[model samples]
Target: MFRLILEEEGYEVHLSKIAFEEVHEVEKLDPDLIILDIKIGRHNEGLLLLQQLRMYRPTMKIPVLICTAAISVIREQEEILQHKGIPVLYKPFDVDELLHIVQQNLLPSETKDC
Candidate 1:
């Protein structure tokens, strides 16, 4: 679903099944933005991945959007993401909202007209 939506907006999207795969792909692709589901397969694994990214200098400045449905659990980690200026999108999100967020993250600062 996410891949399709992103592709429709002209962004090349890659899908990774697990945290390890995601890290591998991110290193290989150096994507303009990363949309991560906060749970991945293990509880908080996505958050763990984000923490690792923060520690790594090469990937530390890349934009990230934390996607999740577990609002209650997310509230606990909200401050962490907020402090990093990472955006959060709850599950069952509208496509338009998703597209808008993607564009905002991927567009260069000089090119952002919205």
Candidate 2:
């Protein structure tokens, strides 16, 4: 349902709980946007992958959407992502709000102008 909404909004969304070669492809392709869940498995694995993305050559500066159910670490997460130029999205948020932010951040300046 949520995927359909994002797709309808013209986003080619890819959902994943794993950071593998496919995700590497997303970086290579450089999609207009991305959203990552915080707890892929355990121990805040999202943060680990995020850190790896920062080191990865292609995705280093991509605007990532970090979705987490944890409201406690929002502040800390903000600081980490800010340094790498990645944005975040907290869980239990409206889908529309999520899409709006993703579109706003992911779109190139020229695309936004259009």
Candidate 3:
């Protein structure tokens, strides 16, 4: 659903089934921005991947939008909260808001008119 809507907005989208897959995709695709869920699968989650990305030199600086329903859970994590640059989007999100955040992260600062 997100991929379709994003594609309709003229952005290329890649869907990954798990957090590890997303890390691999990021390594291969070097995407402009990443929309990550707080809880990806039963075992692996976004916080772990986010930590790995932050440690990796190549992917460290990439913008991440943390979109998830587990807002309360995330707030309890002091480590995740420490990263001020990462933006959080609670679940049941509006498409327009998602688009806006995507554009804001992916576009050049001067080029952003939205």
Candidate 4:
């Protein structure tokens, strides 16, 4: 759903169903931004992957946008995510809101003007 929406908007989107194994490939992909969910197959895999990415050099700077339905989990990690300069988008959001957040998180040079 997100892939189709983003692709229609002229952005290349990559879907990773299993983020843990693919986390290593993220540096190679070198995407301008990453939209992450809190639960990826497991309860805390996303958070763990986020930490791992942050610890690495090349992938650390990539912008991350958290999109999840786990409101309680997000609230628990809100301070940590804020300190890391990451933004969160609650689930059931409008498509326009997603696009807006995506645009905001992308590098200025990479953003496409609508």
Candidate 5:
């Protein structure tokens, strides 16, 4: 669903079912932004992956947007995520909200002429 939504908006989306083991591949892709889900196969695999990605210089500066249904886990790491400038969208979020965040992350240099 998320991929379809983004694609419809003219953005290319990639799905990685085994993202935990493909961090290097992800760096190679050099995506403009990453929308990560905290519960990737395991309860907190996404968080662990996020930590690993941050440690590497290649992926440290890429924008990461976290989308998850795990409120408890989010609360625990909210401070850390905030410090790293990462944003989180809780599950069941409105599609408009998701698009808005994605645009904000991707089009930081574009300005609307008024």
Candidate 6:
């Protein structure tokens, strides 16, 4: 659903499967942004992956947009508050709002991509 809406907005997008494997695969994709689902396995959740990924020097700098059906998503975002550049996106969102946030984060400032 999110992917379809986002694609219609003229932005290229990639949606990953909900699993520990997908997080590791992110490095290969080298996407500009990521939309993460906080929960993964019934036994092992993605919070641990988030921590592991954050510790990885290469991916630590990546901006993450989190969306969850549960309000507890707040706590997860709070845990990563100290992380320099992670952005949180709540569920039940407006498509425009999501795009705006994405553009705001990915858009260039005075600093060029160079």
Best by TM-score: 4
Q: What is the lDDT of residue 112 in candidate 1?
A: 21
Clash counts for the predictions, in order: 0, 0, 0, 0, 0, 0
Clashing pairs in 3: none
Candidate 6 lDDT tens digits, 31-83: 66666667666733656667777787777767666666545655756665536
> Candidate 2 regions off by >4 Å?
21-25, 108-114
Per-residue alpha-carbon lDDT of candidate 2 for residues 15-79, written as tens digits (9 for 90 to 100): 66575444476665565555777677756777777777778878776667777786677676678
For candidate 5, what is the TM-score?
0.89
Candidate 1 clashing pairs, residues 3+ apart or interchain: none
Q: Which of the two candidates, 1 or 6, achieves a greater lDDT against the reference?
A: 1
Instruction: Give me the candidate number with maximum lDDT.
Output: 4
2 or 4: which has the higher TM-score? 4
Q: Candidate 5, residue 99: CA error in Å?
A: 0.5
Q: After superposition, how far is residue 56 of candidate 1 from its true place, in Å?
A: 0.6
Clashes in candidate 3: how many? 0
Candidate 6 deviant stretches above 4 angstroms: 22-24, 76-83, 109-114
Q: Per-residue lDDT for 20 in model 3?
A: 71
Model 6 scores a TM of 0.75
| Model 3 agreement with the true structure over 20-105: per-residue lDDT tens digits | 74455577767778788878888437888988887788888777788888867777864655456677777898988988878778
lDDT of 4 at 44: 64
Candidate 4 regions exceeding 4 Å error are 111-114
Higher lDDT: candidate 5 or 6?
5
**Candidate 5 least-lDDT 10 residues:** 105-114
On a 0 to 1 TM-score scale, where does candidate 2 land against the true structure? 0.76
- Candidate 3 wrong stretches, greater than 4 Å: 21-25, 77-83, 109-114
Candidate 3 local lDDT, residue 69: 85
